[model samples]
Target: MSKVMKGLLLVLAIALIAVPASANLVATSFGFPVIVQSGTTSAFNQDTAFASDFETLDIDFPVFGDGFELGATAGVVAADGVALTGTANVLPFGPVNLAFPSISQTVEQTQEVTHTDFAQTNEQAEFAYPFVGVGPVALPGFGFGW
Candidate 1:
């Protein structure tokens, strides 16, 4: 994998671990889409819209929780494959951070990820051309404790 992809995966993994719920969490996103069209470019200019709904769920078992856990779910949808995603982690310092006062605080940090993608079918309705595209992600820096 590219260094950037590796870094992103690392950051995501850290985000899951940094949050506290008396346990640890591992998460992934599941995407599903629906498309509708008249097979004509003119239809879009006249007035048209398409819809898709997708959701991501976080599932985990805490090492200290005796392998039991609570799950977290987030979702989003858009017209023509555009989407925005956001997630928050609330952390309680508890005994661990309390011992080290400098790190003790109850705060919520939120991360947002946005992406837009699209593809097209040819006259033969063949899913070819790959319709090349690009997606971008703007993630905010970490939010500290209160």
Candidate 2:
């Protein structure tokens, strides 16, 4: 074997040997929006009331800017009070789904959110941020928790 080939193999072996058993993604800048909304013109009448909320989840690495997720909440108090759930793949930078007055669909939905009687703001929006590096020295994860 050539001297260069032997050296390369040796380096690879040492790197592999030093790598941790557990591996995880490393994040750079981490952020997500916990959007809240209320008060519209009409929700089918005074008898019927509706409220919708939205939140986004993102994981960012140095190379990739943002990965996206959309979660929402909806409630209707017409003849009977009802709640619905749904979700969708959203744009990392913006809300992926939207509703417009099309005069076509009656029950319009953007996404679904878990029902929280009292919705909390985005406190841990940037949690689980991972740390970086290549082989022998890479931080695990950060943001809030590591």
Candidate 3:
């Protein structure tokens, strides 16, 4: 080949080697509503009811070294003369790197109507550091929530 052609080929080869492999990224969202009930009986002539609305969104980009996840739920439960309504959410932040070992954090919250006609709320957070080994070997590192 001519010198100019040879130089062009060499540059192309080096560029291909320098570029990183493509990584898969995903993003999606969905919502669902559900209702469940049990059959009534003569002895226990009361029916239980449950209804909920749930929504979730997931975005993953491990190659870029970041990800996000969110889920929320609002529901109601009633039996006999008692009814309770509640809402909950799961939110996460930080890197979601699957190829390399990394740490992630998550926060959760829940609010409910108690039997005493009072609304109560609870919050929690957690951190996890996972060890990603070769092939299929992986160790789920320690995590604590409070």
| lDDT: worst 10-residue window of model 2 | 97-106
C-alpha RMSD for every candidate: 49.0, 39.2, 44.6
Compose the digit string of candidate 1's lDDT tens values, residues 32-62: 2233333633222233355555555443221
Candidate 3: where are CA atoms >4 Å away? 28-146
TM-score per candidate, chains pooled: 0.16, 0.16, 0.18
> Candidate 2: which stretches are off by over 4 Å?
23-146
C-alpha lDDT of candidate 3 relative to the true structure: 0.46
> Lowest-lDDT window of 10 residues in candidate 1?
137-146
Residue-level lDDT for 51 in candidate 3: 49
Better of 1 and 3 by lDDT: 3
Model 3 C-alpha lDDT per residue in residues 1-146, reported as the tens digit of each score:
89999999999999999999996654432323233444433332334444454555443323222344233234466889799987433223355312222234454545443232333445454443443333344333322231
